[model samples]
Target: MELYFLGTNAGVPTLQRNVTSIALRLLEERRSIWMFDCGEGTQHQVLRSPIRLGKLEKIFITHLHGDHLFGLPGLLSSRGYQGGTSPLTVYGPPGLKAYLDISLAVSQSRIPYKIEIVEHTGGTVFEDEGFKVEAALLEHRIDSYGYRVTEKDSPGSLNTELLKSYGLKPGPIYGKLKKGEDVITDEGVRICAADVVREPKRGRIVTILGDTRPCSGALELSLHADLIVHEATFAHDLAEMAHQYHHSTARQAAELAQEADAGQLLLTHFSSRYSSFEELIPLLEEAELIFPETLLAEEFSAYPIYRRQNGQLGK
Candidate 1:
């Protein structure tokens, strides 16, 4: 899986950064992409990346903030024009459906594909055979949310040599073994997956958080996450302002990631005041001091999430 940062600015757009939008691409796993926070110009941003609008399957919104939701109507309409035929589902807070309904109705945009909206209220928002997505309320000015995505563990591949040694030919029985099932061939030979299959492969976990102050929800959501996309809207010196505005500073974000034992931290949602890389380096330095794996998120940058080789999957 790869995470593409389309926008990283907070509140509003700047010359260097857009607002907050991220695309979690799972083309290798499922040939689809899940979007998080469709900020203004997000469609345009996707056009610049390798992401295909047609492959976008779902969208998750953190809150109703304009910087996050303003691009939804335009993106939905454009997806239709771009020939996206599959049904699209959007998950967000309570007012999301109404907001989309009114916007589309007023605009009279006719989308040929079906669109489903789910009003999320924390905990297990979505789960499928391959993955589970959970949400938790966060401490923001409004009812913000943090999402944790966990990929289900997969059964290992069959050992062709071992199966052949057991005089088993490749066929539908191999399919059953791949699913971790014990299979008895028509020849009356029994096969156990545990004896002939490689060990199970561990899954990966990622957590993406919206605007919020340091809180228990954030910590819980980030626990053992392979990569956490969090908002660090201020420098360490501006902790006072960060508290007043219910936003986290770079130091606070790092502290939470450290305490949560997150594998890696990618800090985004930068305040406009820090306009250039030079200005942002100090903030990144502060975060790295607390958590060495910290990284400053940049627009259009992609981070690959991979399964751990050993030990727990987090720091």
Candidate 2:
């Protein structure tokens, strides 16, 4: 799993950052990509990256803000023009269906693929064999939501050496053994999967928040996550402005990461006032003091997720 930031700015696009959009790359696991918050120019942003528009299987919107979902109509139309045949599912708060309906009707755009929309009310919004996605309401101007993505654990590797020690040769039988099936050989010897396989490996977890102020929902969604992506639309000194605008400051984002015990915190959704991202470093350090692994999200930046080695889960 990996996260590729297409746009990181809040409100509007700037010379340095665009609007809010993120791509969760799951090509290795599911041969598809999931996107969150398709702000303006998101389709254009994806054109510059390696991500394929046809591979976008799921889109989760945080709110109805123009900065968060203004690009959906264009993206959906573009997907049809690009020959996307797979079904797409979109999840968001109420009025999402009306929003899409109005956009498509006004533009006279007809998509060839099936598009399913799920209007959520802050709970477990989606679940499949590989993963589950939950949502919680956040303190924002509108009914905004934060998402928690939990990937299901994968089966462990088969102990080939252990199998060989039991006088079993490597063959299709090994495949059955790895799948936790007990097979009897021609010699009347039964082999159980657990006898030759290690324990299952734990899956990775990632939580991403939309525009909001400091709230318990953010912390609850991000609990013990491998990566927590939160909005930081302002600096710490602009706490009042952040609250007024229903946005979070860099320090507040850091504090949420620390409180949630997240493995890493990535701050994004920067305002257009500052041209230089260096100004947020000191504020990020305040978060780093509590949660050492803190980073400021950058446009087009990719964060790869690797399997944790043994004895590294809690840390």
Candidate 3:
């Protein structure tokens, strides 16, 4: 899995950053992409990146903030115009359906495919064979939410060499074995899947949070996550201002990640005051002081999550 940062600025757009939008691409696992937010100019950002809009299957909105959802209407329209026939599902807080309904109706937009809008009130929002998504209310001015995505463990691969030795050529039998089935070979030899199958690969967890102050909900969602994408809209010294505005400072985000024992912390939704990389480095440094594996989200940048050779997750 990989993440594409489309926009990273907070509240409003700046010359260097747009707003809050992220794409979690699961092409290898599911051949589909799930977006975290749809800030303004998000479609334009997709055009500039390698992401294909047609592959977008789901979008999760953190809140009803304008900067987080202003681009949804246009994106849906364009997807229809571009011949996206596959159905799309959008999960967000309450009022999301009404907002989209009015926006599309007022613009006279026509979508060719079916769209499912789910306004969840903080619980298990989505679940399928491969993944599950849960939401929790965050401490923001509005009812903002944090999402936790947990991927299901993958089955172990069949031992091809061992199968060959036993005269079991690759075919349907391999598929059955991979599914942990005990099969009797044509020669009347019974083989257990566990004898030839490796250990199951561990699943990954990712937590994405919206605008909010430090809160228990954030910690719950971020617990032991492989990647924690948290907003760091202010510097360490501006903790008061960040709390007053219902946002988190870089230090606070790092502290939360540390408390949660997360593998990595990605800081995004930066304040526009830090316009350049030089100005933002201080915030990154402050976060690194608390969480050494912290990284600043750069617009249009892609971060890939992979398992290391030692059976550990890394980004």
Candidate 4:
């Protein structure tokens, strides 16, 4: 799986950064891409990338903030124009339905596909055969939420050598064995799948938080995550301002990652005040003092999720 940062800036768009938007590329697992928080000009950002607008199957909004969801109408309209006939599901907190309705009405946008809006109340918002998505209410000015996305465990691979040793030729029987079925061989010997297959590979966990201050919900959502994407709307020195605005500082985001024991922490939603992103290094270093896998987020950057040798998740 790969995470593509379409927009990483906080609040408003800047010359160097756009608003908050992220694309979770699941082409390896699924044929579609899942988008999180379509900020202003999000479709424009997608146009610049290799992302296909027709392939956007799911959208998860964190909050009603303009920076987080202003691009909904435009994206939906463009999806229709791009011949997206498949139904698309969007999940968010309450009031999202009204927001999209008003925007579509005002802009006179027509959608050719079925759009399903699911306004949840902080729990398991979505689940399918491939993945499960849970949400937790966050401490933001508005009713915000953070999302935890857990991919389902994949089936174990069949041991070809073991199968050959058992005189089982490779064919449809191999497929059945991989599916964990007991089959009787030509020699009248019963072969159990468990004895010839390895353990199932663990799925990757990715947690993405909306704009919020340091809170218990954030920590809970990020616990043991392979990748934690949290908003850092301010620097460490602006802790008071961050608290007042219900936004997190870079150092605070790092601390939460360390507390949650996340494998990697990605800091985004940067304020436009800082012209140079290099200023966040010291703040990230402060967090690395506790968790060494802290990283600063950049616009249009892609982070790959790697599986470790021990069947655990890495970076």
Using lDDT as the measure, which candidate wins?
A: 3
- Which sections of candidate 1 miss by over 4 Å? 183-190, 312-315
Q: Candidate 1: minimum summed lDDT over ten consecutive residues — where? A: 306-315
TM-score of each: 0.94, 0.94, 0.95, 0.95
Candidate 2 has its poorest 10 consecutive residues by lDDT at 306-315
Pick the winner on lDDT between candidates 2 and 3: 3
Give the per-residue lDDT digits (tens) of candidate 4, residues 40-91.
9999998888788788889999999999999988999999888789999999
> How many clashing pairs does model 3 include?
0
Instruction: Please give the CA lDDT of all the candidate structures.
Output: 0.91, 0.88, 0.92, 0.88
lDDT of 2 by residue, 3-58 (tens): 99999988889887899999999998899999999999999998898878899999
Give the clash total for candidate 1.
0
Tens-digit per-residue lDDT, 1-315, candidate 1: 989999999999988889999999999888999999999988888888887889999999999999999999999999988889999999999999999999999999999899999998899999999999999999999999999999998888889998988788888878888888998877888888888889887789999998999999999999988889889999979999999999999999899989988888999999999988789999999999999888998788889886656644432
Model 3 agreement with the true structure over 1-315: per-residue lDDT tens digits: 988999999989988889889999999989999999899888888889988888989999999999999999999998887668899999999999999999999999999999999999999999999999999999999999999999998888778999999998888999999988999998999999999999998788889998899999999999988889999999989989998999999999999999998888899998989989789999999999998989999988998765433535553
Order of candidate numbers by lDDT, starting with the best: 3, 1, 2, 4
Query: How displaced is residue 93 in candidate 3, in Å?
Result: 0.5
Model 3 clash pairs are none
Candidate 3, superposed: residue stretches over 4 Å from native:
186-188, 308-315
